[model samples]
Target: MHNHGAVGLPLGFTLLRLILLGAVTVVAGWALVRPFVPAASGLLTRRVVTGFAGIGGVVVLLIAEATWMPSLAAVALIGLLAVPPALRGARPVLGKLVVAAAVLVTAAAGAWFSGPPSSFAYITLMAAFVGVSWLALCPPTAMVRVVGAALGVTLLAGLGQVTIAGQLTTPATGDPLLTRVALGPSPVDVLVVPHMPGWNIVHTTDTPLSVGNAPNALVPALPRDGTTGRWALVWLPEGRGELWLDRAGTRTTVPVDPGKVAWTGPDVRGPEGPDYASAVLAAKLTGKRGDLPWPALTDADAEALRGQVAAIGGPFTVLTDDSRRAAEAAEVVREEAARRGYAVTPGTSEVLVLGGTPPSGARHHLAPWLVPPDLTTPEARRYARTLSAAFPGAAPSRSGLAAWAG
Candidate 1:
């Protein structure tokens, strides 16, 4: 599955988060500056400082409850707003209280959101360290000169815990966990001729199957033996093209000859065989020969086609002749389109006709190939029978029905 990136937060929440972050940064800068400035400077009165501290405390609580990572824009804004206050300084008893209260509030918030950091003993130790440091900084202590040294160790420890937790929990940038492609026999054989070195073909005993990152380029499971652990059962276009295998965010490309890869059936050989009727059907459905399209109507292809039609945002119609195969193919197309919110209205200007003459004013057409009488191979006959069973109606031609085996 593809990672399309994170969804944006709502505008009101984002604005509120920014406001809270700004308040926290300002209050933090003031507290950092408070240790050096003199009282005679009169930069801030105790009354005003206490009021701002209260506001900052409320904002911190809100931020803790929300628990959102600050965006780059918010960080930049905070940095710019912090410069002036950080440069200025003051030494006030109330300033120490403000900083200590902020720290305690933050710790309380962390405990409420995340479970308590480590254990009860660790928590008690941290609290003791904080209390000792606060006592060293307060006016009653002779250790005021050594307050910075006391807090520095505790600050470093907290930073270490944050850094380690972030590293352990977060995946490296641009590196995502990939779902490994299952190894074993599949409906269509995919020949891997590595264009680069350092690649080895491996096998697994996993059941069912996984399409990995190339869901649209292959069919699911169909019984085929003798290819269990050697060859990967994937389908590519019939020619020399690049085949990519992605594992652990690294992609390995290999050149392949798709003509050598065989489909599952008695009469159906590889794409090079004459009776490879599946390829013919895929070509008709996708309007592309021997490229990307598999020899079947895969779910990926259906969804892709639906997305394309939905993107157009216009009305269209699906038409088919009296032939059973043509009607079956048309129904498949109509159903897929409908699933993507594309309605099939009658007499729409855009019409997709299968094995039938386009009605008047029709703009789009997908005519099927008429099977020649001499082209009566076992594979072709099998396709005909499958079509007849899908839609039982008056047959179209004497030679055969439209090919719709997939």
Candidate 2:
């Protein structure tokens, strides 16, 4: 028997989330309506009211994404609409001010208990704060108003955090298991077996895995067989002290023999040397048969890559920069691979970096170690400094770059 583990929110939490979201939505709706409430001889004419209503409706939609800019805009618009009625003949009473402050404090405490504020909840709370402020500035209201305000404040406390926590805590359904494949070479294959579906196994390494670098390092896991799922294999490079695999947040070590696989091919060099070797090995693992091409030999190189794709017998991507030469090189490889009867697309993965712009994208099979471009230019260095000051500890690195792409 296999345990897939808990996969989604608990039934009670799911109900609670729905209820809280619904209450917040109700408060937002009230706030939206409160601004349009017609007053005798007020600044708002029918046409003006309709126009503001239409605009506010759109603002509400934008606040669903709850990005900072849109959220601020929504708050400003709500305040503008609420000001006239809230201010008319309203006295600055100490009791109302105290109540408003208390409501806000209670709402904030609720939100804190729910967890860290997500954008959606934060924005919702902001809008609610505006509404509560408007209420405080207005004349004393009825029992119904008191009840509504209390409920709104209560809902605000739990609204954003519960949803954020639920999303963060949800576990991936599929688990990965590794098995060693001791075939004829120094870089042997290790099969990655997925216990469930929807597993796009991308991150693997030959060293101890960390949250930072696991996504960037190359693992010996080459897909030797054309098949996926149960038949998938990872080619481990020879003489690596250890092999590490990471999926989602889980990490594991796969045991391997350190024996070297003899290489009879022409010597390849440069930063792209590992890329070339990995591409060829990947192709061979997928049962592709072709003559090895020398990297220095352009025609032979294209043919060799073509053979690799032909062996793999599936979709492939060519990672290139914005430069003309890089684009042309990518085109050459794409055309060559396509000629071998497989679809080859432009953009990262099965990567061959010619020059300019670091290789990135989901399908990249090799770790691309890169020097920060900020090291070379004054303007770039200044920008990097500014970014570091703003984000702190987020200075650019290969792993950070890959995670950024993701």
Candidate 3:
């Protein structure tokens, strides 16, 4: 999914370009080959070369799944070349069937393996061969004319249905689902800010920089205008509202209301005291505010937050994916928690089983890396065996064990 250097083209546009280019090339090639076919009827060179070219084109199409070779121009060229073999005089019976079967099979195999884009591109090639074969094999009579007319009508109907279906299924421009996670070609410069106490908000580029992902995550370049040190207050999942409040001397919690505007006090003791400024931020930033009103919190809310932090004892642990960092973070959290009368044990095991579910009031968010069970490797397997022997059934999950040690 993370194709670092992947290039993309709209599926319909790519197919159109392929067909237009192929038509031009095919027309030009036919003009050159028409006169020579009569004079060189017995030569094997033309047959051999055409067969090789057709086979090579099929191979190229299959490989295009992982590579961008035989660009649109090449596809047109090969499709154009196929027209001649298809038009070569009337065949007895078996020879015609063999050619038709081979071409169909080759085209199908190439299309199936070439990813959706390439598969669609080769449809034109298939159509060209089928049409040319029918024209060459049948006599210029009423039956052939009737069959062609029927096929044309059927194709037009099918095309009309497909077009209508496409329009209906397509989302409008502003629809959220149609938009990708972030805008533009460049990756968003995410600033994750987890609600870690005392730590000056850790910043990382890892995506989904919302709650449970980053520590005090901020929007990229929000402080360009130094006059106002503006930081967007974000609401975490489970109706949790957070703000970065640092006043000149007296910093106090902004009363966030789920039904009204969130109140934040200005730095000075003068005018901006109780007349707080508030607005409805993004839902992801404000949890689910649509059903509720704003001025989002009350004094009771501040008391509730205090109680939650008190129950947690203090300080959230931050564990990075790196073993060295996790180990270091674990040591810090363990020491700090123990000092605050909460028992703490830290280990680099594949699994962690806390004695109870995280306390409701506790702001106890584990570092991102610690959320998932670690995998066990040879070194890990040895460690897990020792740990499990000491504490039975304390081993990591089976999948994690396999991924870690395998």
Best by TM-score: 3
Kindly list the per-residue Cα lDDT of model 2 for residues 213-291, writing each as its tens digit. Answer: 1234533333212112121123334321223444333443332222232233322222233323322333223333212
Off by over 4 Å in 2: 4-8, 39-95, 102-137, 140-406
The TM-score obtained by model 2 is 0.24
Better of 2 and 3 by TM-score: 3
Question: Which residue pairs clash within candidate 1?
Answer: 34-90, 37-89, 37-90
C-alpha lDDT score of every prediction, in listed order? 0.35, 0.37, 0.32
Worst 10 residues of 3 by lDDT: 172-181
Model 3 lDDT on a 0 to 1 scale:
0.32
Sort the predicted structures by TM-score, highest score first: 3, 1, 2
User: Tens digits of per-residue lDDT for model 3 on 251-343?
Assistant: 111111121122121221121111111111121122322111212223443344333334555334332332333344445445545656654
State in Å the error of residue 317, model 3: 12
**Backbone clash numbers for all candidates listed:** 3, 11, 29
Models 1 onward score TM values of 0.25, 0.24, 0.28
